[model samples]
Target: MPNRWLCLLLLPACISAVTLDCKHIRIDKKDFDLSALGGPKTIHQQRWLPPSISNTTFTIDLCNPLKKLKGIDSKEQCPSGTRVCGIEERYNPIDGVKEVTEVRPIAGEFSTSHGRAMDPEVTRLKESSNADQEGLRIELRGGKFPETRQGDLQKAIIELHCDAELTGNEGFEDDEAAVDVAGYGSMSKRAKDDKDDEDEDEPELPDLDKGKSLQFVSYKNEKDDVGVLRLTWKTKYACENAEKAPAKEPGNKSSGWGFFTWFFVVSFLLIAAYIIFGSWLNYTRYGARGMDLIPHSDMIRDLPYIAKEWVGGVADRMKSGGSRGGYSAV
Candidate 1:
């Protein structure tokens, strides 16, 4: 009985652990759809340190786990459910070789939060003087660095900028262009073939050019902190007015008559009905004929004379100019 109660209590938390829907992100009563930017993006940075050159590659996917690309090794990448991963390699000039130094899971979890501090935090970026800078910021902080003694948590901060011209896939010539997966070339032929087979099962990435793709701005690692990585991305989906209710089709007419139109229509119908009934009643009862059969005949006939006299009165008033006949007091 106690186990049953515990299961019931845990059901709500499990149900709420589903992945976030990037298509409809509601912020400040406005919705921004980023589904167009859904796919893994890889970035590389190289720095010279003493005799060896250090190269770092970072991969992230907002909508799902990173796919198995051609050059990236499964072992060097993040764990199965990671959303962001970073790997660093050092090249020695003397040995003419490169060595994989670190594989860091920057953000993701094996399962639900379960009271752990593993949930991703998303918030709106503060607006600046430049309109293009408006966007969202996401902070992911559950991954751990494998080299840290204290099991230090890894953090990744992603800033999305609003760029209508970008689709987020710009500058990447091919899927494997930017990826330098460590140890991939050293694998045996059989292992390489197996990896290739796995990659073939995955869906092909879209062929996108710089004209309509997401633009990668920059990546910065805080010098004071080794566990933090900040990256900036520009896409049209980050704009405030990215998605709105689709406009009505041009060929479709309005659903119904407007207020004034209905009012005038109803009014004309009522007046016509009244006149027809009055004329019919007069002809039946008194055998009326011609103009006499019309309702309010006298008033209708006098309308033209009444209008003429009103116009003459206005003309006389204008000519008199409200002047006194006698001389004005001096």
Candidate 2:
């Protein structure tokens, strides 16, 4: 009975852990519709990561006002007459709390074209009620969100979709084209919607093979103050049946000669052929005696004669020196 009483006491604290004043902190619901676009479809995949995301931005509107703005703070203790439109809280996939970022609100009303208007009395009540509340235009800007990996070495499949009309590419023909991800991964076309036969076997096409069986991990839809909706998801790629590319053979390394190499080889052969042709012409014109006209044979024949002359000269010098030595001593 005491344990039950303890649980009852903890429940209220858990509910009020994140104290967001919903009435004062109002976001135009029309600005953010998670279901505005079609369901999430697989758009991209990577060997071990999601689609490259550099930075993120969130535009918000606070009821009252601040002239100069920097960024959103974690505790959200903004100056007076400014309402807290939204709080930017970033959470890691694995680690719990990465940051409680600031909420920057623009200094204007929500555009009528962009979203519906709130009641004038309700707006007045929000400002009059909260002392530290001011209307603001907040843009939450932060560095790239940290990417965490799965426990095991698993590929990540990223699904993406956006409303073409909202993104201003309504007439774009290939907006729905499959994203061929660096050839390491591929996106498949969404399956044809069949309400009556959900269990029917799908045709085994090249793009729709077993490589696409991604296990669902989590899903989220992000929409800015504009009506544009971006749907994204992260899942584990079905890599069990992923086919491995064949290893390159040693013979394939030198499969073809390049232009310069081929040119040098052909030039060498042509020069050799030209030399042989000239030699044959000389031989036909002047018989075997023409071979003696070649400088190679002439140099070989003179080598022995030159050596003999050099030896004779050295012997003559030695004899002269011996004769002069005996005479000088006398």
Candidate 3:
């Protein structure tokens, strides 16, 4: 019972320690805040290889794990704590009949151990690599493919570039095309209607006021190298001047005056009022002159002398070095 309670108490702390903060990402000397693009973004692509057609779906979330959406199944989705995931389905004709040959996870963590250390591997792109390319590179590993020479752990690299106009929906229309080309057939009528209704209900610019959007640029599976997937993302958050906007609460209004500010302001006003009222009283009642009209006049007058004496005593102490423990010679 004691051990169970201890584990429960420590769970929250462990979770917090490993949580990745995508709002503040630093690479080399540059900083990026991608918190605006926190949700998952997905892309689908189809390639026509000689004997088979390959259809791949890639999903990434900068701030959280990819959730299992309505049409996606738990088995087809990546394991929990996965920030980036890719699944590939191959269709081939066997005995004059088209069939699904293979369905496998191409790029993403397969083990639950990823929750222990979930920080994404990020780095800056080399200047000499591409003159036109400038931004941070992120690497996600833990995929397994036995056919590759790069060992069991496959990897994916995503390059984030800065673009002011993209909203991460640039290539979403290609999903239908990919599905058609792969001969995977269309989605069910209910799903299609739901998606269309969602599109109609959504605002044209959902993230315009909050922050900029992320756009999918391209995806390339390195055939020669094998087990490597390269992707590019464009967003204003990846820019050098990107800054995380201050979050606003729904009903709360921002005010410059805080507790200490009000405290000091109130103190000054009260002191001023007291001084003015006291001075008037002294003048009308007793004809007090000069500094004597002030309240607490004696204490106020002695303040300068007190401060000067204090300074002098401190200086003397420093110069004399205080009495040592040794007694004077008799």
Candidate 4:
């Protein structure tokens, strides 16, 4: 049988194409009956980090006000001489304490949107809460980020998000609504072991300026949304200074052939062509493609009758469009 495969081989080049130049970001990072548009997807955020070259934002696991757990921290553990640190009359009061140990923040900045962070209402009631009768501990999870290198890096911001909508079917104005965090400054065991090997008299802190505490907040979106915040490492060069000129390399001319020379040559040719023959080129491209030279010996070798159809059909097709008829033999 004549092979059916020969007919299938030419099918792909005959199909029409669909263009995909459109783009979008879902509103509220939310899920709705967007099945009509592509998704009714759930987009819950679990933590926040800072952006590098641009604004950074992310989310933290929010504790629910109505839930509680017990036995995580006993009331007896609030030591008599423990130290404490907090804003003026702003944090929950630690009671029955003979002493309060002050907390030294590794880095901190107050956020208007992230108020009541160590929310006493949540911590006190969740008996299993990382919260103590003294204070609360918290959990962090669910990260999505592009991979990053672990190098001479001291502080890292691995993810970012914004316009957090955390109220869960509730509007933004509830007075009790707030978000909180609980985590310690962390490093690898290798890092800790390196520290253990060092001198006891002097402590090393990563230079704070390079890894500044970060906060980015915008209140402009909507009532149901928490104002967005981003995180970032401190930039060595301030934004205003990035536009200043690079310093001179100090020479009258470059040393050898470079891309600059190649670009100059190509650009010169294009301008010269536009002035000389661009209109002619635009009009004659099809005529040019149809005009190909076959050597006399090769032309003689083709089946003569099929060759006549090839040449005559292409010429007639060109002439129908009021263009040059392609070449043919007498």
On TM-score, the leading prediction is 1
lDDT per residue (tens digit) for residues 1-330 in model 3: 999999989977866554556777776777777676565666555564433445565666767766655675576556665666666655442212243333334444334553224434777665536557666777765555543455444566778786666533454332331133223322223233544353433212111112213333445446554456676777666667665533532333665689999999999999999999999999899999999899899999899999999999999888778667447867
Ranking by TM-score: 1, 3, 2, 4
For candidate 3, the clash count comes to: 2
User: What is the alpha-carbon lDDT of model 4 when measured against the actual structure?
Assistant: 0.24
As a TM-score, model 1 comes out at 0.54
Which candidate should be chosen as best, given lDDT against the real structure? 1
RMSD (Cα, Å) for all candidates, in order, is 19.8, 29.6, 21.1, 25.7
Error of 3 at 236 (Å): 1.2
Residue 18 local lDDT, model 4:
14
Count of residue pairs whose backbone atoms collide, per candidate = 6, 23, 2, 24
Sort by lDDT, best first: what order? 1, 3, 2, 4
lDDT per model vs. reference: 0.65, 0.31, 0.58, 0.24
Kindly indicate the candidate among 1 and 4 with the higher lDDT: 1
lDDT of 4 by residue, 131-213 (tens): 22221112211111111232111111112111122111112112111112111123222334444554422223222122122
Give the better candidate number (3 or 4) by TM-score.
3
| Model 2 C-alpha lDDT per residue in residues 47-72, reported as the tens digit of each score | 21111211112212221222224463
Model 4 worst lDDT run, 10 consecutive residues: 34-43
Instruction: Write out the backbone clash pairs for model 1.
Output: 167-213, 167-214, 168-213, 168-214, 169-213, 169-214
